[model samples]
Target: MFSSLKIRNYRLFATGAVVSNIGTWMSRVTQDWLVLSLTHSSAAVGITTALQFLPMLLFGLYGGVIVDRYPKRRLLLVTQGSMGFFGVVLAALTLSGHVQVWHVYLIAFFVGVVTVVDNPTRQSFVSEMVGPKQVRNAVSLNSANFQTARLVGPAVAGVLITSIGSGYAFLFNGLSFIAPLVGLTLMRPGELQKGHTVKRGKGQLREGLRYVKGRPELIAPIVLVGFVGTFGFNFPIWLTAFANTVFHGGAGMYSLFNILIAAGSLIGALLAARRRSTRLRLLIFAAASFGLLEVLVSFSPFVWLFCLVLVPVGMMGMTNNISANTTVQMAAEPAMRGRVMSLYMMVFVGGTPIGGPLLGWVTDTFGARVGFASGGAVTLIAALAIGFVLVRVIGVRPKMGLRNGMPYVELVPRPGSRAEGELASAA
Candidate 1:
């Protein structure tokens, strides 16, 4: 499971990310609580969340193109620095008591803009640090490291918010960037693997889309991620509202919710790291399970019950994510890997912008319960739709027997045993 750490550069990257992700999570919890406290409106919280992810929806495709054309390491350095600056500005504003909802929204938008470029570059950059053989392990460990930080970050943020202020939490996040900056600087240039360079030409984005358009195994997972990310995985947006409105708890309860989910996510990532294959069927099952868990949690009457449900929610979420990521990376041709992965990131993260506000509006208009339940229902429907689409489009059929209480889809290639050919022809 820890096989990727055998590489020195990845070890450094992983170590820095562990620290930085903690700070990132810390800032996230504080930011959400701060916004809610200031505005006392779920709509404002959703807008803030939308601002943070809106760029991914608008510019993510372009960002993928940029990741394909540029040196990922250099791109990361610039993006990371930009992110740190935003953190500092947010901290400064909050510290001065001059911060308003619009200020947070603007800063969040700025951060999202930087993230539009940063996210894809960072995702694809992993393969450059560790070769393709270790890509799966590296990806799984990356999630593990982030989720591990998640567990610590929110717990600490809760205490810190009760002690110091939200500004200090933001400051810690800003300062946390230093570790990654130093890690990047200290890395031996010789150890860095070069990423794929795309030929500069017209219709490059179209070309990348066409590439994914022709792969069922790839498109299937991407669609599943889009559904889950857009609807089911937005616990942060709704959970904050739920804690405040439904549960009548404060920031502490919100923080506790995130901590529990993160703990579950950490375990999920570690378990995924042990897997050798990236199966599409596994992704489908995980996504379906994640949706079902969300539905169950929506009905929970108490904070403890809600928190308990988060364990399976986190588990299924990480399973779906890691499985989708590994499948795309392993399936793509080396030359198109960067672009393909960027497209994947675009779908995965980009969906949040549309989903966040819509769900937020649901919470505001109806109630937290309705919002949560509707999101889960949408996820279930989307998962079922995509699963059927995959079977029809890929010419694959689920096995007659149930495995793990879910229908198992087996890849059924045409007579030539060329699934790609079948997919391309169908497309």
Candidate 2:
């Protein structure tokens, strides 16, 4: 599972990434808490989240085009530095006792702007570092790395926020950029597995869009993630409301919720690393299960029960994410990887601009339970819809059977076609 770390360059990158990821998580928790404290409203928190991702929703494709034309490592250096700088700016503002809600909004939007390039660059760079064979493993490890950080960062940030202040969390995040910079600097250029970069040309954005439009395998997963991400992944708004309004807790409770999810996510990533396939069937099942769990947990009458359900929720969510990521990365050609990943990330995250506020409004207008369940309902519906589309596209029919006195459904492929083999493995 850790095989990807044997490579010297990838090892360096992973080490740096983990450190930065921890700080990123810390900032995330602190940022949410800070916004809630200042505004005392989940809707406000949602707006803050929305502003941060709005840039990606608007210009994410262009960022992909730029990533395709540039060297990923070099672009990473610039983007990472900018992120750190923004963190420090926010830290300074908070530490000075002059920070306002608008200040946070402005900075968050800037960070989102930078993320457009950084997200795709970092994703496509994995292939360059570890090559094609190790891409799936490396991707799993990366998720594991981020989830491990999620386990520690939020808890630490909670304590720090209560004892010191949110400013320190931001400061730590800013300083964390140094690790990635150092790692990037130490890498040997001659050892890199470089791919062909797209030339500077017109219609590159349209070209990327057209590329994704024609492929059902890519479009299916992308559409599934787009709906799931926009609706199902608005945990920030839901968790904050649940902690503050439902459970009557503070930052500690919020942090605990995140830690639980992170634990499950870590387990999911590790399990994914051991698996050899990245089938669409797996993606659909995981997503369906995740949505169901979310819907059930939304009605939890006790905090303990609610928290208990989050573990599996995190696991299935992580599984769904890894499956989609690996499928897209493996399907796209190397030359088009940056643009493809950019489009994927665009839908996966850029939808936050719409989902964040909408979910926040739902949580605010109705209640946390209603809001959470609504999101889950949308996710479950989307999974089933997309699964049906895939079935028709692949010309697979469902066969019902009884096994061990239990009923089950399976996809049977058409006779004398390649889809039969695909369905066999995918099923």
Candidate 3:
């Protein structure tokens, strides 16, 4: 699982990422808490979250086109620095007792603007550092790093937010950027394996859409993630509402919830890192399991049971994410990676602007349990719908029976068909 760290550049990247990711998590927790404190409304929290991702919804494809034409390392420097600047600015405002909800909104939107570029650049940059052989492992390890940070960041942020204030957490986040900047600066340029960069031209955006539209495998995962992300992954809104209204707790309870989820996510990521294969069927199963768990957990009669169930929810969610991500990255040609990944991120996170406020309103009007269960129901339905589409696309039928005294489930191609013939020859 740590095999990717043998490459010096990736080691540096991972080290820096862990530090920055911790700060990122800290900022996320503090940001949500701050908004809730200010507005005393879950809808406001949803709006803040939506503003932060709105740019990706509006301009994600354009950002991908730009990434395809530029050097990722250089682009990262600018984007990272910009994000750090925003962190500090927010910190200064909060520290000065002048921060307001609108200030947070403006900054969140700007940060989202920068992310339109940063998300795709960072995703495609892994191949340049670790090479194709380690891409899946590296991606998994990256998730592990982020999840590990999640374990630490929220706990620390909770204490800081309760004791010192949100400003210091924001400050730590701003300063955390230094680690990544130094890592980027220290990398040996000669060791990099840069991919092909597209020249400035027209119709590239349309070209990318067409590329994905024609491939059922690629479209399937993307569509599945779109549903999961938009509806199921609205954790910020759900967690905040549950902790505040349902449990009648403060930052500590919220932090604990995140820590539990992160611990499970860390386990999932490590498992993914050890694997050598990415399968669409596994992605679908993971997603389905994740949604079902959410439904079950939403109705937990006790807080302890609710928290306990969150672990597997996080695990299956991470598994679904890594599987989909690795599948797309590995399948796309290196030349179109930036555009493809940009589209992927766009669909995955961009839906937040639409889902966030809607879910928040549900939580606000109907209560957290109803809101949470509704989102889970949507996710489960989407997974089954997309799974059916994939079954038809791949010409496979789901089979279930007893194998060696154990129940087994698998997908088998239709008999006497082209896909079946190909499978038989391969076997």
Ranking by lDDT: 2, 3, 1
How many times do residue backbones clash in model 1? 0
- What is the C-alpha lDDT profile of model 1 across 1-427, one tens digit per residue? 9999988888888888888899999999999999889888777787788788888888888888888887887888899888889999999998998988889999999999998888878888888898776888899999999999999999999998989889999999998998888888778778887667886779988888898885566777888788888888777778898889999988888989998889889888999999866677788888888888888898898778888998888888898899888877776666676678777877887788788888988888999988988888888888878876666554563222235542222345644435557566989
Q: What are the runs in model 3 whose C-alpha is more than 4 Å off?
A: 393-427
Estimate the overall C-alpha local distance difference test score of candidate 2. Answer: 0.90
**Of 1 and 2, which scores higher on lDDT?**
2
Question: By TM-score, is 1 or 2 better?
Answer: 2
Model 1: which residue pairs collide? none
lDDT of 2 by residue, 1-427 (tens): 9999999999999999999999999999999999999998888899999999899899999999999998899999999999999999999999999999999999999999999999999999998998877888999999999999999999999999999999999999999999999999999878889766988999999888898885766787788899889999888899999999999999999999999999999999999998866767889999999999999999999999999999999999999999899888877778888889999999998999999999999999999999999999999999998897767656654443345533233345667546777757778
Using Cα atoms with residue i matched to residue i, what is each candidate's TM-score against the true structure?
0.92, 0.93, 0.93
Error of 1 at 76 (Å): 0.9
lDDT (tens digit, per residue) of candidate 3 on 67-125: 89999999999999999999999999999999999999999999999999999999999
